[model samples]
Target: MKKRSWFAVLSLALVVALVFTVAAGCSKPSKQPTIDKIKKRGVLKVGVKADVLGFGFMNPATKQYEGLEVDIAKRIAKDLLGDSKKVEFTAVTGKTRMGVLDNGEIDMVIATFTITEDRKKLVDFSPVYHVDGIQFLVKKDSGITGLKDTDKKTIGVAKGSDTQDRLAEQAAKLNIKPQFASFETYPEILAALQSGRVQVFATDGSVLKYYESQDKNTVILPDKYSSEEYGVATKKGNDDLRDFVAKVINNMVSSGDLAALKRTWGLGK
Candidate 1:
């Protein structure tokens, strides 16, 4: 009877030990690294422009995204997750991208997000990936050739974009006060331009090109100004992710892969 009691106690201890061993094996640490979280989730989330063709546009017929920025996001995913298609893209506009990033709805933003001192306070930016300039799109028959001709004309710019402030500063320098109208998206600005609700549609020159291609009557002004340095944006305090993104961008720039993407998208200047 004593021997049977000893065996029962031993078996109970062994079962307890096995339970603890299994629990320890399955347990995760209190805090996991950002990369590990992404790996476990099996998808890298990125915000990109849905309307800006060549930079980031969603092809309606194919229901897939294809653009330079989209490719960049995919490249990042490929390096981190070992598969380019492991990325999920969320469409964002100038007015909404930052909000989404701040809310943790996206891991990062690859939209044509221009780096500015004011924006730096909100999020960290990767190295300048692309350089662009603000330009105008107008009907060829509008008789508006340049900033000098835009005095008192209504200019359409995206809400929460740097274009408005830059345009105002330029207008002040030229001593020509152009009235400004703000829209939520690039497409809305283009539509306002077509409907004559605003005399000019203004944003980054590359973005204007896509709109111009869509409308045969519209022409982009040659007066490109306000150097807009585009960068990838990561959430504030996300140093690891930001550093990784910077490394990837540096590699692309060095290997001429970025230039190749630019040429493929007709973004090469």
Candidate 2:
């Protein structure tokens, strides 16, 4: 009976040792960082505009995405993983990109996102990737030359957009009250502008240029009211991802890749 009892005690000690060995081998020392998580997944998820030509747009004919912002996102994936196609593009609007980025739904955002003091409080922005300003789009035949002419006239702006704020400031400064037509999407704004429902379609110059390019009758007015600084965005406190974004953008700018991309998309001088 004493020998049997001793043998049972030895087996229990051996089992405990084996269990601890396995646990130690299986456990991680700490949680994985954001970069590691992206690399492991083998795909970088990016948020980009689905409309807003020249910046981020999906070509319906080819059923493919193309634009300066799309190129930036793909370049980031290529530089990081050595493959550009290893990325997932999520269509995001001006308002929705922030929520997904804040919730970690996307790895990064290259969606013509403007960098502002208020936005900086919610999420981190990379160094200025591009600079654009608010401009106006009007039909070529329309007599409206600038903001001064719009006295009680209707102007179209995207809902939940930075342009809305700029428009408010402009109204306050000019001391002119213009009716506002708030649309949910850029296409809707374009439609409204084309239909003459609104006398002015105001947004980023790049976007306004796109609208002008599509039809000769549509003219992009020269009134650039506000300077907007565009930046890549990441979740707040995501220093690692922010650093990665900055490095990619810096290299692209130095190598002239960004310039080439903009030229291809018909943006940037």
Candidate 3:
């Protein structure tokens, strides 16, 4: 009888030991770095454009930023932070966008940033969200059909934009010395072209179409300077964040939300 009691007690002790071990293993802390800063701050800082039409800009009457890119950023904030209203918009220009992202001024950039090998070296990009091509915008009466006809004309482009690089490369290839007039924003470039400050405007074909829609007298040239893919940009070395953003974007695309947003914002190709 004593042996039986001893055995029972020993078995109980072993069970307790096993339970303790399992509990310890289960209670181990997660290794992921804390994302509490965003929650505690009660805001998700997002970089967006204030001048680029259809992509990011403010509604004059409502004084709210509304655009396809802005909507995507808001959706991301909603998924991660539980409320779309938590997004705080920061106006960023092409020249300052990457710098602001690298300095941690914003958590992510959804400002029509193009994905390129050179930009990828400084920041991580989510999956290709939109496809575009560089094209030329000219006056309807200019009779300029393509880049080949744009000899010695003043061309307008946003400084620090991918279009600027494409224009430089195209000029180099064609051995054309086209004069360039750099603008601070897309609106300025459009204005410069419309006001005759520059004879031509070079940018993504989609953006050129947006401009042409606003002003019926503008024409987009048929020749494409280069193809580009747009993506969400985050600070470098944030692989986990990049993966999360990419998953959300892919889901958005698959579920037709991205297409709907593009149509609503008049960004559809």
Best by TM-score: 1
Candidate with more favorable, higher TM-score: 2 or 3: 2
TM-score of candidate 2 relative to the true fold: 0.84
Model 1 residue pairs with clashes: none
- In order of lDDT, best first, we have 1, 2, 3
Q: Pick the candidate with the highest lDDT.
A: 1
Tens digits of per-residue lDDT, candidate 2, 1-269, equal 99999999999999999999977854534255788889999999999997878778898998888888998999899988899999899999886888787667898888888899998898889888789899999888889998888879899988757886788778878898888888988778889988889989989988776678777888888878888999998886667888998999999989998888888887756
**Whole-model Cα lDDT of every candidate shown, in order:** 0.91, 0.85, 0.84
lDDT of model number 3: 0.84
Residue 149 lDDT in candidate 3: 69
Instruction: State the lDDT at 258 in candidate 3.
Output: 97
For residue 116, what is the lDDT in candidate 1?
94
Task: Return whichever of 1 and 3 wins on TM-score.
Answer: 1
TM-score of each: 0.87, 0.84, 0.81
Better-scoring candidate (lDDT), 1 or 3 = 1
- In model 3, what are the clashing residue pairs, if there are any? none
